[model samples]
Every structure is written in structure tokens, then in C-alpha cells.
Target: MATSTNGAPSMFSKSNYTWMLIGAVVIALGMFLMSGGKSADPNVFNRDAVYSTTRITVAPIIIFIGLAIEIYAIFKRSSPEKK
Candidate 1:
């Protein structure tokens, strides 16, 4: 059995970390999309801006997809490559 210099195996491979990073970026993007629906005027209310499809529908779907990717990344098994 192979072991590191400290005699402990790494919990995650490089690819796993990459996937996790990608998932995190996706989640951030989703959150960003959900934002920016505010009206410039304090007294004026814009229903369309607040209820836009991108913010109300697309953003939530993107967030859910990102969460799913993160979950998959956490459970994914890494197989060592043969040299």
C-alpha cells in the first residue's frame, strides 16, 4: 500500500478539488444572478424587475444545480492513475 511521507493518505485528489471549486463558482454565479433586481428610486416600486424570470426562476434553478454538483463532488470516488 502506498502512503504519504506522513503515513496518511490524502482524502481528496486534485480532480476532486477542481470539481469542488467549480461547484462553488457555480453557486456564486447563481447567487449573483438572483441579485440586482432593486429599483433606483426608493418611492417607486418595479414589479417586473423584482419578478423577472431570471431572478425568480432561472436563478433558483441554477442554485439547485450548483448544490447538486457540490453534493456529487463530495461523494465522488477518486481512482489512482497507473503510471
Candidate 2:
């Protein structure tokens, strides 16, 4: 059981950090999917682009899944051996 310089023990295990990183990436991907609904011509409105299924439904679902992952990571217990 290695300790930090402060010697208070680490708060998170390797797996927790890995899960957190994965969740962050998923959230970022969701945000990316929800982006870019701009029209090439400023005078014209692109209804389909703004209201696409990917942006409206899939993106939100992905974002929620990412959030759930993050919550799980935070509450996840580390193995006794790892500690």
C-alpha cells in the first residue's frame, strides 16, 4: 500500500481513474455529436441540421450514459488487495 507525500492514502484506485477518464471521453463525444448545426449561408435556416435524431436523441442518451459512468466511478469500491 503506497502512500502519497501527505501520507493520507489515495482517494481513488487505478480502475476508478480509468473509469473516470472513460466517462469524460464519452461525455466529450456526446457533446461533439450535439454540435455543428450551423448553415453555410447565414441567411438560410437549416431545420433538419438543427433537429437531427443524432443531435436530439442519441447525443442526450450518450451524455446520460456518460454521467452514469461517472457516478459509478465515484462510488466504486477498490479491491482490498489493491489498497
Candidate 3:
């Protein structure tokens, strides 16, 4: 094994990983909100259930917000350590 003198830093810091986790959770929440609300009878077509505001409107918006959070996390830089 060769001894190395140069110290290398990781691409992402702990805060970045935490932000990623938060974003992932938010996305999952959005997906969960969008999931089906099964009617008691499959034969009966429930337009209201199918196109509810939460699933159609709110969920997509939430997902977009999560995506934005993820983007922010990816671009955010940690402050350099003071000497």
C-alpha cells in the first residue's frame, strides 16, 4: 500500500445528504397523496373520487415543490471552514 499525502474531500457534506433525505420524503408524501381512493364497487364510476383536487392538483404541486427542494439541495454549497 502506498502512503498518500493529499487529503480529498467528499462531494457532498452531511447537510446535503440530510436535505436529500427530506426532499425524498416530501416526494414520497406527494406520491402517497396521489394514490388511489378505491371505491367500494369497482363497477360504479366515481368521477369525484377519480379527479379529486388532492390527487389531480395538490399532489402534483407538492411533487414539484419536492423536486425544487432537491434541486436546491444539489446546487447548495457548504461554507468553507474558517482557519
Most lDDT-accurate candidate: 2
Tell how far residue 12 is off in model 2, in angstroms.
0.7
Error of 1 at 15 (Å): 0.9
**Which 10 successive residues of model 3 have the least lDDT summed?**
1-10
Clashing pairs in 1: none
Over all chains combined, what TM-score does candidate 2 have? 0.91
| Tens digit of per-residue lDDT, candidate 1, span 1-83 | 23457978877777777888988999999999999977889899899999999999999999998898888887888887566
Report lDDT per candidate.
0.85, 0.91, 0.85
Q: After best superposition, candidate 3 residue 50: deviation in angstroms?
A: 0.9
List pairs with backbone clashes in candidate 2: none
List model 3 lDDT by residue over 1-83, tens digit each.
11224656666666777898899999999999999978999899899998999999999999999999899888888766556
